[model samples]
Structures are given as C-alpha cells and as structure tokens.
Target chain A: MHADPIGVLTGAHFIDGDHACSEGAIAAGCRFVAGYPITPSTEVVERIAERFPFVGGVFIQMEDEIASSIAIQGAVWGGKKAMTVTSGPGFSLMMEHIGLAAMTETPCVFVDVQRAGPSTGLPTMPAQGDMMQARWGSHGDYQIIAIVPNSPQECFDLTVHAFNLSERYRVPVMMMMDECVGHMIERVVIPSADKIEVHNRKVYDGPKESYRAFETGRDLIPSMVKAGDGYRIHVTGLTHDEKGYPDMSVSAQGKLVQRLMDKIRIHADDIVMYKEEDVEGADVVVVSFGITSRTAIPAIEQARAKGLKVGHLRLVVVWPFPEKRIRELAGKVKSIVVPELNMGQIVYEVERCAAGKCNVVSVPHAGGTVHQPKDILAAIEKSLRGT
Target chain B: MPRNEIKIGGFGGQGVILSGYILGRAASIYDSKYATMIQAFGPEARGSACSAQLIISDEPISYPYIVAPNVMVLMSQEAYSKFTPELAPGGILLTEEDLVVTHNLRADVRHFSIPATRIAEELGKRLVLNIVMLGFATALTNLVGRDAARNAVKVSVPKGTEELNFAAFEKGYEYGLQLLKKEPEKILA
Candidate 1:
C-alpha cells in the first residue's frame, strides 16, 4: 500500500540518521512511539514528538525503558503501527518484553542506537556491541529480523523497510544503528508518499464466533484483530493453542514454537538482504555492517591498490546471518575478514558459516570509536598471507 | 575540487556545527555535490571546545570522518589552539579576529581573519557570527559557490531571521572580496 500523504514529509533534507529514521517511521504509517530519552537514539523520539502532533500520532515519554518497550506492544494491539527507541542500557531492560512480543507475534520496531559498553559505557560514543544481543538477548528459539543502516539515507530508506518487514512477518524488527551513523549528517531525499510502499498487518474479518487468534494456513502467520474488535482473543506469554489460551502441554509448546521459528526460517531466503562487490574470483572478502561497512571501504581500497583481489560483502540485514551466502563464498575465497566496532560479535557468525572451508580473520574494536583503516588494512594483508 | 576536508570549531553555543551543516547543505543540496558532516559529542562538546568535521567531494564519500582538514574555521581561541596543528600543510585557516589571537602560525598555510562576532553584534544578534564566518569562507575559498551558500543560508536559518543572516553573510563576503583584492600575493602565497 502507498504511504499516507499526511504523514510523509517528502523533501530533500540534510538531516542526521536519527531524524531520518523518524521521518521513515512516519512515512511507513507508524503513529505511536514510546521511548525514554537516551543518548544518540533520543533524537529519533525527539523528532517523533515534534512531528507526531501534526500527523495525528502519539508520542509518550514512558517512565522507563521497560515500560517504553511494552507500551509499544500495547499500541500495536490497539490497531496502530508502533515503535520504541533506546540504546544499550535500555535495550537490556527491554529484552524480556521483546521475548513477549515474539511469543504473541506482535509487529513492532525497536530502534537501538548502540553505544559503548556492558554498562553505560561511553554514552556518547558509537558501538555495534548489541548485535549478538539483538539476536540472542531475548531468550527464545524464535527468530527476528534486524537491519543495519550505514548512512542517513539508508537510515530513512531501511527504516521504512524495517516496518514493512515487521508487519509482514508479525515479528519485532530491530533498526540496529550506531552512535556515529545516528549523529552523522548527510543529504537524505525522502521520496513522495505515492512512491513509498507501506505494509499493514493482516486482519481477521471472518465471523467473530469462529475466530481463533493463533490459527493460520501454510504460511504459519495468523491474522490479527485489535482489542476493541469485539472478538474473544486471549494473549499470553505461556504456550498458547489456536484459541490463544495458555497450554501447558509439551506438544502444544513444540507446535507453537516450531511455527514461530519456521515462519522466519523457511522464508529466510526471501528475507535476507546484502550487497556484494567483486566476489566472483576474489582471494579475500571483507565482511562488515552498519557504520563499520563504510569505515572498511578505504581499507578494502588500499588492499586492492596493492594488487590484491579483495571483495566486499556488506550486510543490509544482519540477522539470520546470511549463512547461505557466506557458506557459498567460503569455498571460493581463501580468507574472509570481518571488522566491526565491537570486539567480536558478528565475526563468530562468519566463522560458523565459513565452517573451516577458509580462514576467517576478525579485526575487533572495543567500542569507543570506529576502526582505523590502517588496522583493517593490516588485517587484510595478514589474511591474504594466511598468517 | 577533487576532495576537500573542512573542520569548524568553537565553544558549545557558537553555532560551529550549524556553520558546517550550512556549508554541507550548500555543497550537497544546492551545488549538486557530495558532503558529509560528523560532530563531536560527550563532555568535551558540552561547553568546552567542540568541533564539526566535514568532507566535500565530487565522488560519493566512502569514509565518513575527516583524516586531515584542508580548511580550518576556528571561532574561539581554545578551538584555534586545539585544531590549528591538525590543519593540512598549505591549507586555509579562517578565524574570528576579535575572539582569537594568532601566534607562531604555520608558515605553509594562508590565514584570514574576520571580526565575525562584532559584525554580528552590529547586526543586532551575536548568534549569527557563524553565518558571517560561512560567508567569509565562501568568498575566500573556492570550496563552494556564493549562490549555493546564499541559498543554503536562506533556507537553513529560522523564519524571519533570514534577512539578518543574509546581511551578515553579505558583510562577511564583501569584506572577504575586499581582502582578496588588497592582498593578491598573500592569498597566492
């Protein structure tokens, strides 16, 4: 569906990533934002607060991150597209609710503008340390989609895509940004509302008496009904049957959990997104995402200038790990180099996907700032030398 | 220009970041070029020396941060002392004449000074000093065109203040043009 013209601010704006993400959310038909003020990510909610009034949207400054996270889920059930913005410390607080959203198949977006730390570390700096946490932070076997944006333009474009994916799969999607990209300013051209596609959750219009909240067809994704729809629907964190009632049986748990996992796993091929350059016959390929992808370019160029055939694989969607593509490249390339702001989160995933077919090199950073190109270059040279 | 890295620095509320943003908008939006701006954060940026780093080029920018700036716009003495040594050799240095004093300046670089704050006060707002510095930089350096910079200033400033900002820009630009005519050898030096 095309975006609503009232919510879309179509123009050539010189804005930062946080503001761009807010514009993208508005363009994507999101009308509810619940968040607590946090560094870097605060601008996303700040912009939402300023713009929501004009567009008939709601912005609530929740008591804390825990309340903020769950409030968005509540808004979702009230027939509104919703999101919550936070950083590392707040992201940690929202983990249990993220699990709840997955359990109940809530469609929402979580914006984590990552900062340095295990605990409030370097509040104003950049880091990709929450990557593993985004995937595994919420304890569960269920899967979620996470997208990484490298620039303010992507911050706008991919945010719209994030909402679409979340609504399509009925799962929480993570807009994984870092402090650097969140604060960096660039020209972001937001297209007209007619050109943008927005996805809304499917609703159950069947007879209210026959409505089974968790019932689905082959796709394993059930249609949703809001709270005031006068349909009897039970939503719970416990294992639920087709009637959405709590089921304690092991078999019920297996069936419901398996469907939740397969809905994403079976469609992984269609959901995964990435960008590749010169990987056909390259000896070494550099794997990176988010802000690190931009930072790794100069290092890749330096490697190419020294007569080395280096390729680049930048992950637009970081989760689901792009296992198939990494496995395919491992056979052809001699080494894969992974660089990120965190010490080593996504690199291990690369190593697992490589599966010893080729050597995997990880250039790790402690998270206060981005990686130096020379350091990444040295790693590329070392990877090529098999040292 | 193939590529130019510029850094603007001052105290917290001196509009250092806004100056960089205007220049970037001028290059990227108005002039159809590419520009990227990154501002410093944390405790240092609260009240002490803060800075905004920018890069403008004909090609798409791969790396975001500036390695070494070819142009340095210093609006305060603290910013001047902290950022001057990092300026690339043979680069251009623009400073606020009344707020900063230069000593042992680099010989390889050309220096230009403007009383931007005083000029802005004369225009009834001390906040527009950054706009004045922008106009001075536009006239002295070939980084961006005059029309593009003027257009950016027109749209970027708050409503009803565009006239004041434009006047401040014109005063600085006219002052820069006069300086260029008076010291042709110095500019070329």
Candidate 2:
C-alpha cells in the first residue's frame, strides 16, 4: 500500500541520518513512538516528536528504555504502527522487552544507533558492536531481522523496509544504525507517498466468537485483531496452544516454539539481503557493512590498482547472515576478508559460513572511529599471500 | 574536484553547523554534486569549540570523515588554534577579521579575511554572520556556484530574515571579490 501523504516528505533534502530515519518511520505509517532520549539517537525521536503533531501521530518520551520498548508493542497491538529509538546503553536496558516482544510475536521496530561498547563506551562515536546483540540480545530461541544502513539515503529507505518486515512476520525488526551513519548529513530524496510501499498489519475478519489468535493455516503467520475489535483474543509470553490459552504439554511447547523459530528460519532466503560487486573470478572478497562498507571502497580500489582480483560484498540485512551467498563465494574465492568497527562480531558468522572452503580473515577494531581503508587493503593483501 | 574536505569551526550558537549545512545543501541539492557533513557532537558542542566537517565531490562520497581539510573557515580564536595545524598544504583559509587574529600563517596556504560579524551587524542581525562567511566562501573556494549558494541561504535561514541575510551575504561576497582583485599577490602569497 502507498504511504500516507502527510507523513511523506517528498523532496530532495540535505538531512542527517537520524532525521532521515524518522521520516522513513513516518512514511511507513508509524504514528506512535515511545522513546527515552539518548545521545546520537536523540535526534531521531526529537524529529519524530516535532513532526508527529503534523502527521497525525503520537510521540511519548517514556520514563525509561524498558517502558519505552514495551510501549511500542502496546501501540502495535492497538492497531498503530510504532517504534522506539535508543543507543548502546539504552539498548541494553531494553533487552528483556525485546525478548517479550519476540515471545508474544509483537510487530514493532527498534532503532539502535549503536555506539562504542560493552557499557556506555564512546557514546558519541561509531561502532558495529551491537550486531551480535541485535540477533542474540533477546534471551531464548527465536529469530529477528536487522538491517544496517550505510548512508543517510539508505537510512530513510531501509527503515521503511524494517517496518514492512516487522509487520509481515509479526517480529521486532531492528534498524541497526551506527553513530557515523546516524550523525552524518547528506542529500536524501524522499519520494512521493504513492511511490513508496508500506505494509499494514494483517487484521482478521472471521467470526468474533471463533477467533483464534494463534492459529496458522497454510501460511505460518496468523492474522491479528485489535484489542477492541469485538474478538475474544489473548496474547502472552507463555507457550500457548492454537486457541490462545496457556498449554503445559510438551507438544504445545513444541508447536508454538517451532512456529516462532520456523517463521523466520524457513523464510531465511527472503530475509537475507546483501550487495555484491565484481565477485566473478575474484581471488578475494571483502565483506563489510554499515560505515565499514563505505570505508572499504577506497581500499578495494587500491587493491584493484595493484592487479589483485578483489570483490566487495556489503550486507544490508545483517541478520539471517546471507550464509548461502557466503558459502558460494567461499567455494569460488581463495579467501574472504571481513572488516568491521568492532573487534570481531559478524566476522565470526562469515567464518562459520565459509566452513574451511576458503580462509576467513577478520580485520577487527575496538570502536571509537571507522576503519582506515589502508587497514582493509592490508588484509586483502595478506589474504592473497596465503593463497 | 576529486574531493574537497572543508572544516568550519567556531563556538556553539555561532551557527557553525548551519554554515556547513548550507554549503552541503548548495553543493548536493543545487549544484548536482555529493556532499556529506559531520558535526562534532560532545560536551564541547554545547558552548565551547564546535566544528563541522564537510566532504564535497563530483562522485558519491564514501569516506565521510575529514582527514586533512583543504579548506578551513574559522570564526573563533579557539577553533583557529585547535584546528589550523591540520590544514592541508596549499589549502585555502578564510577567517573573520574581527573574530580571529591571524598568526603563524603558513607559506603554502592562501589566506582571505572578511569582517563577517561586522557585516552582519551592519545588516542588523549578528546571527546572519555565518551567512556572510558562507557568501565569502562561495567566492573564495569556487567549490559551489553563486546561484546555488544564494538559493541555499534563502532556504536555510529563518523566515522573515531572508532580506537581511541576503544583504549580509552580498556584502561578504562583494568584499571577497574586491579583496581578490585589489591584493592578489599579498593574499596569494
């Protein structure tokens, strides 16, 4: 469906990534937002607060990140697209609710403008440290979708995709923006409302008395109904049966938990997205994402200049790991080099995917700033020497 | 240009970030080029030495941060002292005459000065001083077009102050042109 006209800022604008992300959320029909202000991520909610009044939306600065995270799920259940924005420290505080959202199968988006570290380290700098956290932060066995945006334009474009994916699978989609992309300003062209595609939650239209909130037919996803829609529905974090009531049987646990896992695991191919360039007949492939992807370009060009067959792979969707593509490249290429702002997070995933078919070299950094192109070039050079 | 990294520095509330925004908007939105601006975000940005880094290129900018700025626009003494050591050799330096005191001038870099604050005061709003410096930059750097810079200034400034800002811009632009024409050797040296 087309976006709402009032929320679409259709023009060429010189804006920062934070503001672009807010526009993206609004364009995707996100009318309710609850967030606690945090550095590098504050501008996102600030812009939402300023623009919500004009776009028939609501922005609430909750008391804390835990409240802010769950409030978005509540808004989602109320028939409104909603999101929350935060950074490293605040993202840590919202982990329990993220698991709650996963267990309850709530549709919402969590934007984490990642900064350096384990505990509030380098609050104003860039880091890809939250990559593993986005996928595994929430406790227990479930799957989630996360997209990393490299530019302000992608910040707008990918955010809408995050909302669409969340609504499609009734999962919490993480918009993983780093401090670099979050603060950098560039020209972002927001298209007209009709040109943008938005996904709305699937609402049930069956008999109210016989409504089953957890029943799945041919499709793995179940249709949803709002709280006041004259339907007898119950949602919870417990392992429940198809009838929406708590079930203690091992079979019930298996059915509910397996569906939650299969909904994303079975649809992994559709969820995995990446950008590949010059991979054919290449001896080495450089895998990177977010700010590191942009920083790796000059180094790739420099490698090409030195008569090396180097290819580039940039991850748009960091979760689901693009294992198929990585395995294919590993079979063809002699080695794969993964560079990131963190010491080593996603690189482990690439290594696992490579699986001894080719050598996997990780170029790691501790995370105050982005990687230097020369460092990536050096890694590429080293990988070639081994082969 | 292959790429030009420009650093605009001053204390907060002097519109240091706004000037970078205008320059980036002019290059990207109006001039059909790519520009990326990254502002310093820390405690210093509140009331102390704040700066904005911009990279302008004919192609899409990949490396967003500035390594060594080839163009430095300084509006405060603190910003000048903190940032001048990193200016690229044979670069362009534009400074406000009243606000910044020129010292330890580099031989390879070209220097140009304009009393942007005085011009903005003459135009009846000191807040438009950044616009004045922006106009001077449009003339000195030749990185952005005149019409593009003018349009960006109009679009970026607050409503009801377009007239005053334009006058301030024109004063700086004319002053830059006259200085270049009158003392090409001294400034170029």
Candidate 3:
C-alpha cells in the first residue's frame, strides 16, 4: 500500500497550508480533482492544476461549486481517487451532493477551507463556522468523517489520512481547514513514497453473476466495482436492497439506512484522532481544534506560569467527536474550557459530553481574526473559579 | 534568540511578501529555526498597501500573527507611516532612503536607511530592489546570516536571474557594512 513514487514530492518545502494539502492529495494517489476557484482554498486546486499533468492526473475547473462537488463523485465511480476544494459559500452549495455521496457510499474527500460566514461574510478571513454544517449540513442520518489540521505540515500529512479513511469506510471525508491555516506558510517535509501508506477501496472479487453491490460481509461495508469493469451493477441514492435496486418497503429503508450509520459508528474508536498534553490530575483542560489549537497554546502556558495546572486537548479529527475521551476527562477534571474561531459551535458538543459532571466554559469569537491568548487564559481561569 | 517578530510592508508589486518568504526560508531551512509567515489579503489587487508578518524563534511558535514587531522593513512612504508606530520600543527600523523620508523619528528606536532602489538601478533592474533590501537587513539587523540569506535568494528567485540578484544583494550588503564601520555604536547585539 505504499504511495506511488511519481506522485510523491520528497523534499522540505516552505509552503502554505493550501499548497501543502495539494501535495498531500497528490501523494495519496488521487488522480482526479474538480473544483471552482474560491478564496483561501483556490491555491489547493491551482497547485493541482500545475502538478497533475506530469503525474497522469486530471484537474477540471467546473463552472460552479455544485457541478464541482458532484463531478468528483463521478470521477470516483470511474476508479480514480478524487476530491474537491471549496470555501464557505461553495460548501453550502455542495451540501446536497455531500448527502448524495453519503447515500451512494461514494468514497471522496471534500476540502473546506472555511472563512467567516452567513452569506459571503469576510471572504478572506478565517473561521471555524462550518464545523456544525460539515456534520449536519447534509440531510438524513448518515455519518461522515471530518479532520482538522493546525499547521502546513499537518495539512500535508492529514490530507493523505483523509483519503485513506474515505476509502476504508466507504464514506465521504471532510478536510476542515480555516483561512489562517490555509494561508500560513511554514516548513513542510514530505517523506518518501515508500514511507507513506495508501489505501484503495476493496474491489468485488466474487462471481459476476452473484454480485450484489450492496451486499456486505461482517464489517457492514460492501466491496465496490467500477463502471467499465465488465460487471453489471446499479447504484442509486434511494433506499435500495442488497441488489442495488430501489425498494420502497419499510424494511429495506431501515436496513439500508441503519447499515450506513452503523458502518461509521461501530468504527468510531478507530476513526477518532486527537492530541493531549498534561491532562492527568489537572484542574482545567482546554479543548481546541484547527487554528485555535495553536492560538490556545500561549494561554495554556500562561496559565501554567501562574501556578495553575492546565491541560490541553487538541482535536485532529473534529467529527466523530471523541465522546468516550471527553466523558472520561469530565469525570476527572473540575472544568473544561473550549475556544474556537466561530461563536460557540464545538462547545455545545463538549457540554453534551461533559453531562454536568463539571463546569464547561466556552470562549467564543466571531471570526475575522484568531482569539487573543489573554481571552482564552481568562476563560480557563474562570472555568476553574466556577468549580 | 527567544523570538524575533518582523514586519515588511510596501505596495503590492514591491515583492514585500517574497522578501518575508526568503527571510523565513533562510531561518527555518538554513539556520534550523522555526519560522512562520502570514500575509495580509484584501480587495486591493496591485500597487496598493500590502504587508507580510513573520516570526522566527528557537522554540516552536504558538501564535502565528505578530503582536509588536521587533524589526520593520518599510519600502514606501505609506508603509512607513502605517507600520512605524507599531514597532516595539528600541526596535530596529530599515527603510528605503529615497522612498520614505523619516521625520520626528523615535529616539529610542535604532534606524537604518539605504537607497535599495538606487542600488538596484545601478545594477540595471529595479525589480531586484527587494533583494537589495534583504541583503541590507541581513547585514545591519544580524537576524539572519549573510550566507544563509544568499542561499535562500539563490533558490527562491526564478531561474536564470540568480547572478543579477546576487550582485544586487552584495552591493547592498557592502553598503551596510561600510555604514556600520562608520558608526560602530549602531551595531546591534
């Protein structure tokens, strides 16, 4: 499962987050990219367009975001690992197709370089406002995985991981980035192709006549077959049976929908990823993700300087929200402080998981700029005072 | 160094961002330190106010944006007027002599001026003025080593233009060294 040598760029580069993410996608065996230019995220596709030609990849700039989003799914069905890059406005337009990708179990990646929003608000500024939307934007009860990267290095590393997760679970993966992380420049060292692991979707190997597209083994994830692979298969967005035929029966609806949800839920422990520091016997733990994670570090350090025992929990994977870990930490610590670029999105999830066992403090900001360390330090001190 | 915050400001086409990028590349790549650069983005396309903020530290940087810059490189009158007030007390200020006329300057801050545009013109390309400024900053500020800065300029600029840029850089660096020798008290620690 090692990466292809032609796609990997093995060197140390001083690149921005968007460009690093593009390199990561290329290293992960992605051969198809469809996107519409948008602020903060356009650099990802721009780099792809420049690099794809040499690696036998395709980069298509569609007319609109709606077309760009669904076009990646079509590319996936043609046996190419694919993805699309976008920002807030385009992310909103792609919600329906995200739902469609989930319903059809199309393995793809959606890179949302978020900006301040609620209808074209501060297009060049940073925000984590799309966090809730990425989880619940698509209607229905299916599950998708979302990952947050804090630095240009992680933008290169985690993007490859995002693709692997999508192919393994047969669900769409969201690469949730913000304007700050998207534009910040730093040194990113891409390893050699032999050191990187890439995962491809399992292909159906059974007899063609007995092939059922939706039939599953013990893992609840079915094997896939491409369109031109000399196999007769049908894929639909409606409630379908194991034969991939549209079924209106109540049993079929429950069976199909339940499997989709259970596939991710059952493997939530394996999909969840995070980083923690000094949480063992600490009074307050600061929970943060994306750009806010780096911004919160100075606050954590200042709190520690003042003779306060403060811990930090940075979310590398924002979705499938580390429920078990939060529940465990809530029982041990006196309080938890959550800070984000958006005004109180992930804090509610913290509150829900804490379940009143300890006080939860939310440090909210309406996005354009990142939070000052003093504000987060104040919130951390306040959370401890309430207890 | 614990940490050094730098701000470079000029018009959009003056290569303000690229200067910051070269400095950052020298520190992080050649000197083996941590550096982060963030640029200001807005509706202004070209020939308007633009800035790039950078931080270089021995330890990992937590916050990405610069608070109060310890060093400021201003290439235009507008940039000089806008960014000088935010300079840290006793900070280093480098400006283009012909472009920015400093008046009512702060007594506590150490200031240095060079005709970077004039030097580039003498070398036959005004586009390499930013490279000249980078050389002067390397000599006067002592934030980055001269050899590291030279290597960065070699790799960062477009192919086939290294000779002219290097000549421009050495001219500015020699000018800075002569200025320091004339006034030894202005030498930075």
Candidate 4:
C-alpha cells in the first residue's frame, strides 16, 4: 500500500534522525502517538506534535512512559496505527505495558533512542546498551522485531519498516536508535507517497456474530477487529484461548504462548535483515550494528589496507539475532569481532552462534562516546594474528 | 579535498551547533557532497562549552566522530582553550575577534580572526553571528562553495530573517576576502 500524501514530505532535505523518524512514522500511516518527552528521543515526538495536526494525526503527551506505552495499544484497538517514543529510563518504565502488548497481540511501534543508562546514566550520550533489553525486557516467552538505523535516511526508511512488521506480525516493533544516530544531522531523501510502501493490519471482514478474536490461520497471526466493530472482543494479559477469554488451563497457556513465539520463529528467515560486505573470503569479520557499525567501517578499511583479510557484517535487524547467518559466517571466517557501545551485549549471541568454530572477540565499551576506529582496527589486527 | 574535518565550538547561547549544521548542509546538500554533523551532547552542552563536529567527504562518511579537526572555529575563550590543542597540526584556526583571545601559538597553524558578533549586531541581530562566522569560515577555507553556503543560509534561517542573515554572512565574507587580498601568500592554500 502507498503512504498517505499528507504525511509524505517528498524532498531531499538536511535533517536529524529524530525528525526523520517522526516523518517515517507519519508516512507509515501512524495517526496516533502517545509519548512523554525524554532526552535524545524527545525530538521524535516534538516533531510529531508539531506536524500531526496538519496530517490529521493525534499526538498526546501522556503523563508518563507507562501511560504512553499503553495508550498506543489502546489506539491500536481503536483502528489507528500508533506508536510511542522514549529513552532508556522511560523504556524501563514501559516494560510492563510492553509485556501486556505482547500478550494481547496489539501491533504498535516503540522507538527507543538509547542513551547511557542503568538509570539515567548519561541522558545526552549515545549507547547500544539496550540491545538485549529490547529482546528480553518483557517477561515470559515472546519474540519481537527490532531494527537499528545508522543514519537519518535509515531513520526515515526503517521506521516505515517497523510499522509494517508490527502490522504483519501483530507484535510490537522496536526502532532501537542510539543517541548519536538520533541527534546527528545529514541529508535525508524522503520519496513521494506513491514510492513509499505502507502496511495496514489485517482486520476481520467476516460476520460479527461468528467472529473469534484470536482465531488463527496457518500463519499463526489472527485477524483483528477494532473495538467499536460489531464483533465482541476481549483482550487481557492473562493467557487466553482462541475466543480471546482468559483461560486458566495449562493447555490454553501452552497453545497461546507457543503460537506467540512460533509466529516469529516460523517466520524468522523472512524477518531477519542484515548487510554483508566482503565476507566471501576473510580471516576476520566484524559484526556490529547501529552507530557502531558505521564507526567500524574505517577500522575495517584500515585492516584491509594493512594486508589483513577483513570483512564487515552490519546488522540492520538486530533482534531475532540473525543466528543462521552468524553460524554460517563463523565456519567461513577465522574469527568474528563484536564491538558495541555497551560493555558486551550482542557479542554473547555471536559467541553462542559461532559455537567455538571460530574465535569470537568482544570489543566492549562502557557507553559515552563511540569506539575509536583505531581500537576496532587493533582488534581486527589481533584477530588476524590469531588466525 | 578527499575529506575535511571541521569543528565549531562556542558557549551554549552562541549558535555553535547551528553553524556546524549550516556548513554541513551547504557541503552535503547544496555542494552535492557527503557531510555529517555530530553535535556535542553532554551535560555541558546547555549553558557551558558546546561544540559540533562536521566531516565533509567526497565519498559517503564512514566514521562519524572527528578525531583531529583540520579546521577549528572558535567563538569564545573557553571553546578556544578547550579545542585548540585538538586541532590537527598545520590546521586552520578561525576565531571571533571580539570574544576569543588567542594564546599558546602553534608554529605550523594558520589563524584568522573576524569580528562576527559585531557584524551580526550591525546587521541588527546578534543571533546571526553564527551566519557571519559561517561566511568568514567558508571564504577563508575552500571547504564549501560560496554560493552553496549562501543558499544554505537562506534555507537555514527563519522565514522573514533570511535577508538579514544573508547580509550578515556577506559582511563576514567580504571582510575575509579583504584579508585574503591584503596578505597574498600566507594562508590561501
């Protein structure tokens, strides 16, 4: 489906990632936004509030992050594409509602422009510390889709992808942006409405009397009906049956929870996205994401210049971890170096997927600024020496 | 040039970030090259010393942060003191004549000063000091085209204030050109 013309700012312009993300959400047909302003992520909502009026979108500055999280889910049930924006501390506050959204299968977007944090550690600095949290923050067995954007252009492009994945899978999609990517200014080319693709949720079109809220086809994703529709729908955090009623039986829990997990697992191949460069024959490979991946480029080039066999693997879709590709690359390369803003988050996933076939090194940084290209280059050199 | 790293530094109230933004926009958007601007984002960014780092390249920018800026523009004493040592050897240093007092000279460095704040005040708005600085910086260094910088200023400033900002920019640019004409062989590489 094409984007609505009103929301599409079709031009080449200089803008920051936060503003680009707001434009992305609008072009994806997101008409409802509930958010509380926070550092690094505030510009996304501020732009939304300023532009929403012109496009017939609703922007609500909620009381807190918790309200903002749940408010988007409520808007989803009311037949509106919705999203919320926050940073690390605010993301922590919204965890419970994120879990609620997962159990209820409400499609929504959560944009976390990550800052340094255990708790408000550095409100202004960039960090990839929230990578694992985005996947495992909510309790129980559930899966989510998360995309990390490196540039303002990606911030505009990937946000539309986040909404599309949210709608297609009936799950919350996280746009995990770091502070640098959120604040850095660059040229962003937004295409016209006809060129942009948008996805709407699959809604039930059957008779209201015969509607079963959670009934699924082979795809595992159930068609949804708006709250005001004639169909009777009940959604709760408790494990529910296909009819959408709370069921206490173990069998009901197994079926519902397993379907939630399997929906993503079964479709994992199609959902995983990444960019690979020169991995065809390499002694060392650098696996990085977000702003760190962009930072790794110079290091990779320097390693190659020094007569070391080096390649780069950039994760655009950070969640669902891209285990299959990592495993395949592990066998081909001598070692894989993972550099992240956090001490070490996704490196563990790489280690597990590599399964000791190749050496996996962690280039950990405690979150303030990005890693020095020299440091990453040093790691690549060390890995090549070990090989 | 293959790639050039530029740093703009000043106190918070000064348009340090906006200056960097305009330079980057001029190079990337108007000049049809690649430019990336990373603003200083720490506690000190608000009222204390704030800065913006920009990289303009013939190819797409890979690393976003500036290691050693080949060009440093200072608008305050604190920004000068804090950022001068970080400039690359044999680099160009541009300063606001009224605000910053130069010290601890480097022999290989080329330095230029302009009264950008006074020019902006003469143009009737102190906020356009950054625009004046941008003009001076653009004229002194061939990092961006003069026409590109002027176009960037036109789009960057608020709607009705474009003419004033453009005039402020021209004042600084003319001053810089006059300096170049007076000293023929010194810093015009």
Going through the candidates in order, the fraction of native interface contacts each one reproduces equals: 0.85, 0.87, 0.74, 0.90
Q: Which 10 consecutive residues of model 1 chain A have the lowest summed lDDT?
A: A378-387
Task: Please give the lDDT score at residue A103 for candidate 1.
Answer: 97
Lowest-sum lDDT 10-residue window in model 4 chain B: B180-189
Q: Show the colliding residue pairs in model 3.
A: none
What is the Å distance of residue B99 in model 3 from its true position? 0.4
CAPRI quality of model 2? high
- Model 4 TM: 0.97
TM-score of each: 0.98, 0.98, 0.99, 0.97
**Local distance difference test, per candidate?**
0.93, 0.91, 0.94, 0.92
**Residues A1-387, candidate 1, lDDT per residue (tens digit)?**
999999988889899999999999999999999999999799999999999999999999999999999999999999999999999999999999999999999999999999999899999999999999999899878899999999999999999999999999999999999999999999999999999999889899999999999999888889999999899999999999999999999999999999999999988998899999998899999999999998899999999999999999999999877999999999999999999998898999999999999999999999988899999999999997843
For each candidate, the DockQ is 0.86, 0.89, 0.86, 0.83
For A1-387, candidate 4 gives per-residue lDDT tens digits of: 999999999998899999999999999999999999999899999999999999999999999999999999999999999999999999999999889988999999999999998999999999999999999998998989999999999999999999999999999999999899999999999999999999888889998788899999999999999977778889999999988999999999999999999999999998999999999898899999999999899899988898888889999998888999999999999999999999999999999999999999999999888999999998887776656
Q: Between which residue pairs do clashes occur in model 1?
A: none
Sort candidate 1 into its docking category. high
Off by over 4 Å in 3: none
> Which candidate leads the pack in DockQ?
2
Query: lDDT tens string, model 3, A1-387?
Result: 999999999998899999999999999999999999999899999999999999999999999999999999999999999999999999999999999999999999999999999889999999999999999998988899999999999999999999999999999999999999999999999999999999999999789999999899889998999989988888888888998999999999899899999999999999999999999989999999999999999999999999999999999998889999999999999999999998899999999999999999999999999999999999999998848
Cα-based lDDT at residue A34, candidate 4: 98
